[model samples]
Target: MDYVIEAPLVCVCDLDGTLLRSDATLSGFARDGLNRLINAGVHVTVASGRSLQAMRALLNGVELGLPVIGLNGALISELDTGRHLLIRALESTPARAAVAILAAHGASPLITSWDGTQDRVHHVKTMNAASDWWVAEKREYGDPRLRLSEDLEGVAGQEDVVLITGFVPDQAAERLLEQLRAELAGAAIIHAGQHIYCTGWTEFQIQHPQADKGHAVPHLLELTGLRGSTVLACGDHLNDLGMFAAADESIAPANAHASVLAAATATAASNDEDGVIHWLLRRARLIGAS
Candidate 1:
């Protein structure tokens, strides 16, 4: 599909393997280039598995012209005011069932929920090395929502449970994914596969049935009065497939997973090469060194 520059346009981007480098950091070149796109009247926003606060930390200096899709599209929050535009929270029954299934399969989840005003993340002490590393990384990032929980199952019964995520070995992940699908059925939305940054480890995320980038994109278009706009999306993992399907055009980084590359309408340089912003700049017809 051809994108007309003159028409209203929206660019929804993924963070991990699509925008941020392997070290989970954003480069100056990307930051500047993204700001330029926003300045030049391209409606830019992010769709990420990261929480809103974490996303903000990574995008500290950049301006997002629209609400961001967070928690793998379970949450959508306004950029400047921090207001929630939409939240597809998982119900308590399904949440508890999912937690129990994960535990039975030898995985403990980091549970995330919204309490109207802010996020509350409940985590067990540690189930494995990967879980320990995940907690440490969040601490290093200054994640304020981290709450030590002795009863993760109880936390899952909360009213607004948004995300249940964890990491496991690739082999275990496959089994766990199969079980969750067979058991949970239509109760939750599940995304599981190899981690984009942490090799040998697979990440599993469970959320509300309507929660995924594809569903969030249409809501965002309506909220921003851009439903008629040409929508372009960028992503780099299995979780990104939903957004890719929803977008008019989808761009995947060269380093993206094989499935992601195959699904994309076009490809760009790898994340280390600052691909996303470069692609946007060229598509927007903006002049800048890539």
Candidate 2:
């Protein structure tokens, strides 16, 4: 779709392997392209798996006025206000059940709880070497938010958790993924990145069924009061499929996973070469914003 009419368009972008380079930094090419869109009056924001805190950290230099989607749709936070427009948390009963099942299968989850203003992540202190890698890697960033405990089952007893995520070996991730999907009746079980961020690990995440990127699209649209605007989405993984379903059009980077590539309306350059920038330049022009 050209989206060339005189009306504004809404562009929701995924961060990790879509807008950010492999090293997880937004490139100047994209920054300039986004600025052009802002000047042209398009509504642009990010929909990412990153938490709100992480998104703000990653978007340090960018002056984005629009509210960004975070935690894969678990939140819609406004940077200027330091407030959340939406909060979707998992129910206690099923979430605890999920943890028990995964734990039984030798998976230790990093439980994510949103205490309205911040994310309180709790993980079991006693764990195997595989789970330790994910924990240690985050610690290397000096992110003080993670709260580890030897008594994680007690720490995670509450039901208002936003998400629960974990990492495992590539071989083990497959079996856990299947088990989580079949057993966790009321939740969303997902797998991503066989080797996330260059690390040789596979990731697993669980959330409320309502906490989906596709749902975030409409929530953002409603909150912005930008009804009827064309939805332009871009992503690079299976997790982005929900975002694609909510779009009038979608783009996937050249390096995107095969499933994401198939779902996109078009394919652009790889992330390392400013693929999102290339797509946005065209979008800005089509809407007379260029």
Candidate 3:
């Protein structure tokens, strides 16, 4: 006997190194392809490590109104309003502890929070030169949530922080990861990527245990009334694993990280080659999107 599935299909995509090219911009082919997908009754949206504001900034002119997953799944919200569909925040105690650990080791971590209505980011304790460069870069993009402080003291008092990120030399990042694992047991410690900051070879992000793309994507599917339907998720990094885990079909660019490539159901072209667009068009055709 054969089974027939009735739920609608939804396509969830990652931003960096997946949909967006190496320069952090979307290609014309991708934009047109996604717009066409949306027009064909296929739900299209972004699930990114970027904050809500950053997402809008980077995706400018794309003409999309769907919800987005932000801050590595700490936030799921409307792209325009930043209203949270589902949120998981790091408690004040842990947020402070995370800050303390990074500060003690001369690492100035960037703190992010989603308090339902808006997204806020806090940076504390005398930033290093590289940290300053990162701040300047984001400022050029009109990042409004970036709050600078002399120290972590009295920032967002009593309010929960959702994500904490830091950058350090590859070796130091490794050590920090070990230290964080031991100090912040049960906390999500992720070595996000490498060569991200001007002075560092690795970037690490810490978040609430439930702040994961896997959980967030499923929640979105449920909200869209597509529960149990075939979900096509795409990405090129470890942060994308959560979404991959929740997807029935997962796609990774040819240049994806080793781990991601291994887990992907199939490989698409490299982002520079517009592999995501190719996959989407092919998928839409297969599903008879006309």
Candidate 4:
């Protein structure tokens, strides 16, 4: 497969169930496809909700020199320099208030902070399969600053917090979001799918006060020194909608969320089918050469 393209084109990909299969591993086909693109000089960057520490492990062997967009755009860091290009922390007042509201609703809120580098997330005792994502990352990154509090009042005041997440049972997630909207009037709330709820501060106050992937994409383009038209973004969740909306062209894995699939310009194979590599090869014209 010789889908090799020239350098300077920017390709931003979402990690977790997008680039990596459900087992949290990248397929050989995806790796080779991405390598072909990089060898041809295209820039590839991972845009993910995972902290830098977790992302580093997943992207460990891949060699693409680009800053990653983490925490759904709350943090952007240069891979080589370790310098953060952007850090959008939710205002403490609103974060704290939002935490209180979730606690009252009996939601298990997790507070996350950037430890100058990488995220330090705190969660309660209950566990689920999705919890594997966080647990494995924590083991790899070392134990996080764990806090098991019923009240989130003090959790929000921590200095330099970037994201706050909570888990709602599949049945109640939607209703919780509606109630949250009414309670946290000015805050950013997003349905991250898989029964996960994300609440944070908005990136901008002037235009749309919502914190979305759309707002994050423009900032990423500027940081990568590419125009939106020159960028190709791939994602699989609703949180990826903004990024898809902002990309010059975008692809969603076949198993992607319905909304995300609808928003993307193209659909690749499922992640298990090595969709990242499949699409890259097709787009770059690297489909079947040595």
The numbered model that scores best in lDDT is 1
Give the per-residue lDDT of model 2 (tens digit) for 46-143.
Answer: 99988776777777766687899988898888976658889888777667766776677666777878655566878887775657766776676665
Deviating ranges (above 4 Å) for candidate 2: 1-5, 126-133, 136-144, 286-290
Task: lDDT winner between 1 and 3, please give it.
Answer: 1
Candidate 1 per-residue lDDT, tens place, 1-290, comes to 22335666799999998899988999999998888888878999999998887888899999887999998889889866668899999888889988888878767688888876778888887576666777777899898988999888887875489999878889788788888899889999998877666678888899999899999999999888889788999999888999999999999999999999999999999999988778888888776535
- Candidate 4 accuracy as lDDT: 0.68
Model 1: worst 10 consecutive residues (lDDT sum): 1-10
Q: Over the stretch 210-260, how does candidate 4's per-residue lDDT look in tens digits?
A: 345566767877776666438888998877887887778889999898988
lDDT by residue (1-290, candidate 3, tens digit) is 11222345688899989998887789987887777777666777889888888888877766665688888888888888767887888766667787777776666787777544566777864676656666777899988888766556345345567778767666677677778888878755454568532534566678888888988988887776777777899999998987898998999999899999999999999999989778877776634222
Lowest lDDT block of 10, candidate 3: 1-10
What is the lDDT for 238 in model 1? 85
What candidate 3 gets wrong by more than 4 Å, as runs, is: 1-7, 115-117, 196-200, 286-290
lDDT of 2: 0.78
Using lDDT as the yardstick, the better of models 1 and 2 is 1
Clashing pairs in 3: 214-242
lDDT scores of the candidates, listed in order: 0.86, 0.78, 0.77, 0.68
Clashes of 3: 1
Ranking by lDDT: 1, 2, 3, 4
For candidate 1, give the lDDT.
0.86
User: What TM-score goes with each of the models?
Assistant: 0.94, 0.89, 0.90, 0.83
Measured with C-alpha atoms, the lDDT of residue 62 in candidate 3 is 69
